[model samples]
Target: MMQNHEEHDHHENGSELSEMQLRVRALETVLAEKGYIDPAAIDVIIEAYETKVGPHNGARVVAKAWSDPVFKQALLANASEAIVALGLMNRVGDHLIAVENTPRQHNMIVCTLCSCYPWEVLGLPPVWYKSAPYRSRAVNDPRGVLADFGVALPADTAIRVWDSTAETRFMVLPMRPAGTEGWSEERLATLVTRDSMVGTGLPKNPKDA
Candidate 1:
């Protein structure tokens, strides 16, 4: 009887998964039929984001900045140019701005109107970042949103929320974790996370890394 129940549960789970895939395919078909989206173009974009471009690029940028104060200064001064120095200037990165999170100030990014993310640097925007609740709350109540993401800041810490637009996008430069004064850029890059760049989470601790 237990074996039969387990088999039935597995079948149900697989059925649900297939159903979700079908729904996604149907949506894609409808969008394509209406000429609102090109399936081939989408495939290319997805492949680029998933493989050629991603958080690794952003991580490298962060690592370099963390290790070099001069580069960090240049980054804060002209983020778009600084990132171009790292070869991530094309595709939704025409105007990029880097906001630093300090001891007294926290930074977060949101696109209330649309999901205008820094795909060139951070790759795809996470599902949560594109959600209605996060969009509304990230601007309306940033501290509360951070708390929901399990990011606790001091009561005196000021939360700064940056709204992204079609023309400009923002990336959060999270504070470097302590106790790793001589770490290599390659090692430090591993500590930087997608969420940390998006301002929803912090960098991985050295021990955790």
Candidate 2:
């Protein structure tokens, strides 16, 4: 009986090994035939995920805020609650914080320890955003960091840098772009890029890319 039990255990272990081997073989075949994965492929995959399953919902929220004064006030007052009101607080470990950007005060966000982003609202952070240079330097020298991103603020313009924690996430509510006077919400959402929502880039105008 003991020998039979040992044989059963060996069979189970062998089955598991075979399953793993099959998976590895399949992966190897795909890799060799399809060629090694491209680094740029990661960006394309992430962009696809963002379009299919991420912060596009929040883009609608921002567009609504831009068009409606009351919603904008609610969003500015309590971003997490406002987002919940829009039925978009579904992701785990996501805590939303809104930072408003204005002519006088521009807001930028960074996480020094890790990439703690408001993925529900802004999708994945850009590559530069997760870099150590950006995280370490943004808090200490916000103006310079913005300058590096090609955003040169006026000397008098106050820059507010919000450091996100693992438990809390943040997004930038960019000032509504000019000349978008009568655009629909969907049209406005087109201008809201992930970079603009992260404060590293401004919303693209109708003419601008």
Candidate 3:
């Protein structure tokens, strides 16, 4: 009976893997036929993930932290449970933490060991994010790296650099941009960019662009 159960489990796993491959192949075929997928279409996919599969988990947390002081405290104290409380615990690994960036202290995240991230919330890390130069320089010279990204901080502001190891991953809770008071959550989410979450850029106001 034990051997039979093992075989059944293996079969089910193989079937699921096959289905995933088929879906990937279909997507590749569509991309090939189009010659190039629109960047806006990628945004649409990201939006769908945020709505359906919950890709904007970190963004939602940031928004909540902005509005609620208690939750923000909890997030700072224990990010893994705080995020799980927000219904974002379906991802693969554990050890997810949130770092907040304030006016006085700016926080940046980098994985020197590997490209570890909170993908359930932030989606895929950009190509530059995973590049060796970014990983190496971000921790050694954060101000210089941010300068390269065109993000300038005041001389009084202190930059806190967090290194993500093999076990724990980090995300940045960006300071809410100015001039976006009394906005709905949906509208606020539009301002939260991947770069902002990665601590490379600030959230852009609708009026700015």
Better of 1 and 3 by TM-score: 1
Q: Candidate 3 on 62-132: residue-level lDDT in tens?
A: 77777778998998887878877877565534677788888888878776333266666777666577779
Note each model's CA RMSD in angstroms.
14.1, 14.6, 11.6
TM-scores vs. true structure, each candidate: 0.74, 0.71, 0.69
Using lDDT as the measure, which candidate wins? 1
Superposed Cα RMSD, model 1: 14.1
- The sequence of per-residue lDDT tens digits that candidate 1 reaches over residues 1-209 is 00111211111222222477579889999999999999989867765655255444888889999999999998998888987776644433567889999998888887643235786788777657878999777766777888898898888888777777556688999999998799999999999988999899999999988
Which ranges in model 2 have alpha carbons more than 4 Å from their true place? Answer: 1-55, 88-94, 113-115
Candidate 1: segments with Cα more than 4 A from true spot: 1-56, 88-92, 112-115
Clashing pairs in 3: none
lDDT of 2 by residue, 1-209 (tens): 00111211111222222477579667766876687865467567865665454545667878889999998999888888887887756542356778888888877777643336676566666667778999777766777777787887777778777766655667899889889999899899888877778787788877773
